[model samples]
Structure formats: structure tokens, C-alpha cells
Target: MSNKKQKMDPRVMRTRQLLRDALVELIDERGYEKITVQDITERATLNRATFYLHYSDKLDLLYQSTKEILNDLLNNLNVTFEDKVEFDFSKDADEPHDTFMHLFEQISLNSKLYKVFLTEKDIPYFFSGLKKIIIDFISNGINFTQPDDKKLTVPRELAVRYFAAAFLEVIVWWLENDMPYSPKFMATQLMRITVKGPYLEHPFGK
Candidate 1:
């Protein structure tokens, strides 16, 4: 596993990128379930044998592609928060934090693939992978031990799940609506919601 983290040969990396791009294009053109290994290799302009060198089958390609996407997200977050003492949302309006902006930018960059995956694909594996990534990110960044006056009433895990689910739904909605809002604006809105606690006052009575 450690060896896998080492830099890969440029030629090999280029080949894998081509294959991944081809898969994304094909998935967007048709659906993932309808695609085959031959279709991927043909679209990638690589031989079946070459495709086999990197992935066992179309499913293997899907798994590897999903893993790469999640890793990209995690890496961006790690780099953005590496030296920070706390999450900062007060940066200049034009200069949004990479940690927050990267998520929206990535989705925008790969909007076609994401739209297909979130709506057309029946794979639960992708959602599970994404949820785990979000949970890990929140778990690492947050101090679970609350201050005496602001104690959390819910379990840490439940809070994480609630936040993650809500965020995911927001992403889906944004994509479905063609992302009318800019990434910076979307990120700022999310930060605002997170920083401001939910309103709990009853409209009818105390």
C-alpha cells in the first residue's frame, strides 16, 4: 500500500488518466450500467490488453475512478487546513478558502459525471464512499468535546451524519438546478448556515 503512494511513471499516469476520462465521457453519453470494458477501451483508444493492465473490468474502473475523486477532495481539504488553527470564513469575498471552494469547483468541473452518477447510476457504493469521506473530514476538523456552556445534546456521530446528509442534499439540488449560484457564493452560504445555529423558536408559542 505504501509503495502505491509513491510517484507513478508519467507514461502510466497518462494512460490511467486517458482511461478515466474515457470512462467519464462514456458514462455521460450513455449510463454506467450499459457500458462495457470494450466500450471503455475503444473510447480510450487503448487495447483490451492495455485496459486490463490497469483495471480488471469496467467495475474495477468505476471503483478506481471513484477512489481517485474522493482522494482529490480529501487532499484539497488537507492542504487548505494544514496550518490553520480554526476554520476561517472571513477571507476576502473573492478569496474563498480552497477547502470550501474545491468541493464546489470539483463538482462544477465534473458536473457531467456527477450529474450522471447522482441521478442515473444506481450505485450506492459512490454515496457510501462520499459519506465516509465527509465524516472523516468533519471528525478530524471538529473538537468533539464541547465547551461547558455549549454542550452538544446529540451524539457526535449523529451530528456528523446530519450535517453530511444535509450538505449532500444541497449539492444534489445545486447540480439539478444547473448551479445558478457561483461556487464562492455557495460556499459562503454554507459557512453562514454552519456558523449560525438553527432557529428553534416556535412560531405559535413558547
Candidate 2:
């Protein structure tokens, strides 16, 4: 698939951005369940007709806005973890944001939107798709890193699920706690997990 993202018309982009920002702010103030199309349009200073012109409903608006950011993140990332190394764990946010930084940076930039989506996760595709990205990456990395001669103690599917879910929970925790760390700090931690894992030894003899 072509990685080049199609350019959005500036007017359309601005309208959508207004709607998205309004939705996130309203959601943060109230909650998704209590929000309405009229409420969003009023907050955005756009008419209800404009909202309908752009979206079928409030849910559609939420989906499109979140999807747009997610797609942008995936496109910019283009991360091929093929034989990647971890020599730069101590790197700070001043460095160029490539690879892992792209992921965390996107999250940091859209914290309000994400915090709302993550907490109101029942709306569908809002949170699960985000988790799936992590799952897929961890799966691909494990497959690439494993040696042919050595068998994994845990099933590959189980390993992928555990890591993906744990990583997502970490993200949720970060946002919930007001993101005390920077994007680079979060990215560094993800790299550490990707490389060395938690290293939790078994309480009982294997």
C-alpha cells in the first residue's frame, strides 16, 4: 500500500479540527455518553448543519477524528523493527522523533482526545484498534527476534496478548496520571520493554 497520505483540504481540515477539539473538550468536561451533536457544534462554533455535512452523528465524528490521528501515526511511524537495537535508551526528547517516539509523541500531542477515548472505551474502535497496533508490533518483533534453535517457553499468541495488553495499560495509566513523563521518556520505556521485558522471575521453581 502507498504510504503517502493524501492531503486534506485546508477548510475541511480546519472544520474537522474544530469539531474534534470541541468534542474532546466537552468529553473531558462531561463524558461521551452525555454529549450530543448539537453540543459539539455549539462548542465548535459551527452550526448543526455543518456537523451533519461532515458526520452522520456524534459517534461518527469521534470515529473519524480518532481514526485520522491513528492513521497519521501509523504512516509517520513506518517502523520496521527488523533487527533493531537499543543502544539509545538514554536519549532525550530533544532528539528527532522517529520510530517509537512517533507513537508516543502522537499520544502526547493528543492527550485530551486519547484520555477521553480511553476512558470511554465502550464506543467501539476507539481503544481496541490502538491496542491492536501494539499487539501487532510486539508479535512481529518476537517473531523476528526468536532464534530457530530455541523454542519459546510460552505460546507465541499468549506472549503477544500479554505484552500488548500490558503495554496498553501502561499507556492508559500514563494518561490517567496526567503524563508526568515526556514522550521520549515513554518511548524509552517502551523500547526497554521491547528489548528486555519485565524480567519477572517465577516465584516457584519451573
Candidate 3:
């Protein structure tokens, strides 16, 4: 997908946006468990019939809203990320940095939705969906180095999951801490780990 969102019908988009905004605000005020479909419809100023046309229940509404945000993240990434491409680590950091910069910026834009998704206990389903998306995206995009001269200590799948989980937890930490560092700084830190291993070299080897 392109970085720009596709044109959505104004009326349908407006209705969904109202519903999504209502859900977010209600989650903040009364918490997810306390919220009802009625509360969402009322807050959105739409009737139950209209809400039902778009969603089945409050959980459905919340789930769909979270999904829309995730889709927006993909669009915000601003590159043809789905296609497999060779990632040359020998090159300057700018290549990786640009990708992460777009990512971190998108996360910052949707920080509220992410904060709610990461922190809320009622949305394990949503969280799992989010995790799967990340894992798939990472697995698709990254071309991990493999050579005849080397053997990995762990399986590639394990390593990918580790990276995906760590990436998510880092985002959660940044959001929880109100993003103490700029996106570029965080991207730099992550890039350092990605291009080089996370620790210092032994025996002064490069």
C-alpha cells in the first residue's frame, strides 16, 4: 500500500471515525469492560441500527477500530515493504534509518490507540492480531544474513519472533514513558542493534 490512505466514502468514513473516536474516549473514561455498544452509539451520536450496520458488538467495534489503525500504520510506512528486497548491511545506516523513521513516526501518530491496545487487558484478541501483523511484516521484509561459513545458534523463526516482540515492547516502553527520545534517536538505537548485534564485539573484531 502507498503511504497515503485510499479515498474512503465521506459518510462511511465519518461514521466510522466517530465510532472509533467514541470508543477511544470511552475506554479512557469508563474503561473497556465498562463500555457498552449503547455507550459507543450514544457517544458517536448514532443509533443502534447504524452501529449494527457496521459492527456486531462493542468488542467487534473495538477490534475493527484497532485494525483500521494497524492498516493505517502499513500505509504510513511509505515504502513498498511487502516486496522482498536485499537489505545490504554493509551500506550506510540511511537505508534502514529511513524505514524505521517512517515506522516510528506512524507509531507516534497512533500513540493513543497503541497505548490503549498495549495496556488494555480486555483486548488480548486484538493484541494477538497486532502481534501477528508485526511478525509477518518483519519476516517478509528482513533478509537475514546466511552464509555457508556460518551457523546460527538459534533457529531463524525464533530470532524473528524475538525481534518482533522486542520491537513491540520497545514501542510500549516509549509510549508509556511519553516518548522521551525522538523517533530518529530511537530508530538509530534500533538500527544499531539490527545492523550490528546487540552487544560489544570480543577481541576487538569488527
* lDDT of each residue in 14-75, candidate 3, tens digit only: 89889998998888777899989889999999999999988999888887787778777766
Model 1: per-residue Cα lDDT over 5-76, one tens digit each: 466887898899889888888887887878899998999899999999999888888888888776766665
Q: Tell me the lDDT of model 2 at 2.
A: 29
lDDT of each: 0.72, 0.76, 0.75
Estimated TM-score per prediction? 0.77, 0.81, 0.78
Candidate 2, residue 66: CA error in Å?
Answer: 2.8
Residue 32 miss distance in model 3 (angstroms): 1.4
Model 1, residue 60: what's the lDDT? 89
Candidate 3 backbone clash number: 0
Lowest lDDT sum, 10 consecutive residues, model 3, at: 141-150
Give lDDT: candidate 1, residue 159: 73
Which candidate leads the pack in TM-score? Answer: 2
